[model samples]
Target: MIYLLSDLDFSLPLSNPVVVFSLVLFIILFAPILFNKIKVPHIIGLILAGMIVGPYGLNLLLRDSSIVLFGTVGLLYIMFTAGLEIDLEEFRKNRITSLVFGLFTFLLPIGLGSVAVYYVLNFSWPTAILVASMFATHTLLAYPIASKYGINRIRSVTLTIGGTIITDILALLVLAAVIGTTRGDIDATFWVQLAISTLVFGAIIFFVFPLIARWFFKKFEDAVSQYIFVLAMVFLGAFLAELAGLEHIIGAFLAGLALNRFIPHSSALMNRIEFVGNAFFIPFFLISVGMLIDFSVLFKGLGALKVAAVMTVLGVLTKYLAALLTQKTFRLSPLERGMIYGLSTARVGATLAIVLVGYNIIIGETPTGEPIRLLNEDVLNGTIIMILITCTISSFVVERTAQQLALQEENVPRDEGDSNERILISLAYPDTVTELIDFGMMLKPRHSNVPVYALNIISDESDNGKTKTIAKKMMDKAVHHAAATEQTILPLTRFDVNVSNGIIYTLKEQNITDLIIGLHRSANQHNFLGATADSILRHTSETIFIYKSVQPFNTLKRLVVVVTIKAELEPGFAHWFSKLTTIAKEAGLPIDFFATPETIKELQDQQAAQKAEVKISCHAFSNWDDFLIFSREVKKDDLLVIVSSRKDHVSYQPSLEKLPYYLSNYFGSNSFIMLYPQQVERGIKMDDVQFVDGSLAETISDSVAQVSKAGRLWKRLFRKV
Candidate 1:
């Protein structure tokens, strides 16, 4: 049993699981690193590695059951991620364009390919149609490259994903019908049954699954449990799709769509999903694709070579034609056309599924008593080779196109001041840490390099040993939670005489632009602003957000922003506006702004200038006399954002003093934010002041005082409105 390596048999194909696993892991680790030096896309490297080590090459590994299982999961994960990351709003806007592209991609290939397959390959009608259908179908194998480049939100990418689902459905339908015809099951009743089952399956995936996922997420807070629940839902959808006569990928995609709204693109859950799939499952799938290639068939005869060449040419050409037609019809850019073609050209998942189904159907036998299958060995081998070629072209083209697009978009202008914006979250209550971190993340700008800070301040009088241990645990949890979302949270703990002083000190030291703290849970009518929040607000000049949530941010239905008249004049107006709109866009929620006519006009102008994709509806509301009237406009599930102000600020009102008391009494069950925007610092540095124009400076100061006085007068004059 203690045999040495020299004494063991050196097999051509490795059978030991440990050896096979080590070889695959090594391939996964080094293939990308090795290929990066040569400037080749790592996706190509993985596939090539698989081919070199597969049974057809050096025979170091076989495509065993374990490989097949992992590969299948990887394929489904790719489809799921495609759906999960798609912009739902964009998808809706381009549904018609997607349909046009889908029809072109599907019909062009099948129509031309059938003729080529029949005459060039000399296949019969049934077999020819099946083979041609393979040309119409393609997998999203190159999507990971596009995702890595961070261009998934672009219009061209959204259109490709939309078209992908459309064409795949049509392609799978064709496979079902062709198989039915071959099996003598293509009767009227069979079509009716298929239609009914497909509808039922769609309803279950799109309608029922979301409800389940929503409830499950709200009830369970454990990260591991939530991840496992999501995976279970994905496979359940896949299994049900199979029972309904559709491919598992279709179900996996639909499952993603159903849960899309629940998972924010930048949340911890989305990061985990993408991380696992990209790091492990997706690589496994890519390797298995290369293992399907068989070069020996090409050397055995010319028939297989001819078939492979024809299939590859038709597949690539037809897909290009489809992309070109879509470009012309939609007036898309040349770069976008190239992107579509690259994404739609790869043929692997559905192609293999259809070919295997055809190859397994036996119709007759030769005089030698050999069974004559629907798809011969030559076609099977040709399909495998075609997979290799198309995948290579797809990976290379997508990589180049994605790089170009990312560069082009980077040159476009974005918000200016946000490049330096950093957010700090003060963690006190154990239950509010996750929501606080999530809120901070949503408020931060996308693709920002600034790190989020989570702080826990321990009282100096408390026993250092026990208190420090507790604070350390809390900080560690905060860091781990943020890391799941691919974000780095700097965890800090300090001993201070006052809790608010600790937060204020950290804010100044870190140059934090925004401070987010949870509203006190035990505050009564007399103790409303909570000692800590009040103290921090009175001491700091940065933007401060006091939040309390009765439900998860993702589960909220809408964001209702109550803008005070002149609130837009605050120093931090643009910063807070940008944050709210970003949250709306990421959560895929519409926003309703209740403000005075002047404020509404200003908001509309800002929204148009930013060209934000959020659905915004502005309503005229200047009812300062009774702030409670606005409470009727808010639903229990809505996120209410009351734009309050400090007493020294221009937007401050007498009615705002009573806002906390009113909210606790009337809207106690709803999630709300008391947002206080940054005000101008009061102290002016004497060194920076100049006496170049004494009269001019004095006149400007007098004019500012007059404006402040006039603003108060206007508020009084229109108090009843």
Candidate 2:
């Protein structure tokens, strides 16, 4: 039998979604790797890849509806994440500096760009102003690079991020005004309508959206629903912004700001949002941006090339001048100035948006009565080239300058008085993994290189292949949750005959000084500590924190810290106090310290010495009994922290053992933590101390006491009558 062989078709049709999607996915997957191997920025590689597979190149893909849909989503995602990821504390501290930079960056570009476009390129008045505004807008294309280098917390970076909001708003406002004027609607009525709509939109998004979101998040605990709710808010904000005759990006950024406090930077929800954006939406946007380029125009004649060169040079130079002026005024270092310039130079998202808006406006007619486009094809093509060039330069400069800035920071000693400390969270239940990680993050030392440890211990008897696999998967979930907060979690899996022993062994091996474990009810009714947690607490000499969370940590209204007399004299007081302050600051709540006068004085001294930012209010208590009275003052939303000592320690007391029971009875509806501070060992030998198995004796005593109390109360009531 003769076999008929046909030549395989090389062309793929764009009508088939599968074929187009597969090709794009292949490009997205390999482009970065190929570029990385050649020492090129992955962003540039992605854009180039898009061009190669674009309609103008091999004609393999079509610029269909999917591009527009994903492109818009990607643009909004970038803006939303920018607003969400900002260091709010730092932003507040440098608000004035940001305002100054915003004005400088905005004004400088408008002035310089207008002159270049009007005099050099000889564009008309309206056209010149519109194009000038394009130069005024810059995307945070280099921000990820700065964040990667761990210098994102610096004042300069914070200011740059803040300035981005101001400049983009002003630029887009100019675009809106120009569009209105071109459409013959620039009158008193137009101005009034615009102003009123904008104010109403702001009120709805900033005030209404947050209220709804707070209620939604509180009502729903499902992660998938939460993620979808956030997406809905983003699109809703975009839709409202368009309705108000403003850009959708403005709405997206505002939506981020609105929900910023609800979703902590280190939260699992924030992580999921960023992951989805970076992995899919953002890449699609970059590819779509690339497809807009037509390289044939660059080689066809000198006109397009001239326009591109002029736009690129003017854009970079104007942004550089803005940075230089801001640096001089602020007395910043050259490295800082370079970083500011780099971060503010890239023209991409906003630039494209403005150019597209301008390109669509019909301004005047030619001699033949044909409509004369406000932004010509040459200007559009030129802007695309400018985006590619500036993006490349911005990325390179940011990488180099960020490295140098980080090095300078390393050489300079920090005066913040915070020490490097690692926090380890023990995972018991899969459902509570994210909550536990978030707790660790709230207490983690900021701007430090220490990584958080998440330990999952399995008993040796249950350490079969399937059990180990399940444990690994659970640990992976914890890791992903921590990763969202931009935190590094060293996941540890250990096996021992006892779960607590396994955790303790891993802690020692990891050299962890701070341990956090979830609180669980013991099988024995009288035992406050679960068997596993109690064992670890009794055996470990390090600082231990037992957390029982009833609500989200961010919702806490107050942090009531109960400290025993002389508790501040312990070896771990200063360290634990520092961590406490960190949590208070991260929670943005006031701390009420219930301690003796001397202990309060000591804590105050430590706070003043460390220059801590948390606000602490001292409430005097003579002894541990006074803590019982404060239970009435604790609200449902308050977080109670009892600072206790180990058995036989200097600060240890009989009442300390009953503290957990009292809290369980009085503050059952609240979240509470029992922190055992580290103690200094005495000269007594280990064998001299008697270890008692209180499990049996405590159970017997509890039963006998209940029976006696009931009989005595019943006899008294009956006999007296």
What local lDDT does model 2 show for residue 592? 93
Predicted structure with the largest lDDT when compared to the true one: 1
TM-scores, all models, native as reference: 0.89, 0.79
Instruction: Write candidate 1's Cα lDDT for 100-182 as tens digits.
Output: 99999999999999999999888888888889899999889999999999998788988998888888888888888888898
- How much RMSD separates candidate 1 from the native structure? 5.0
Where does candidate 2 have its weakest 10-residue lDDT segment?
Answer: 696-705
lDDT of each: 0.85, 0.79
List ranges where model 1 is wrong by over 4 Å.
1-12, 457-470, 491-497, 502-510, 569-571, 624-637, 682-721
> Could you tell me the TM-score of candidate 2?
0.79
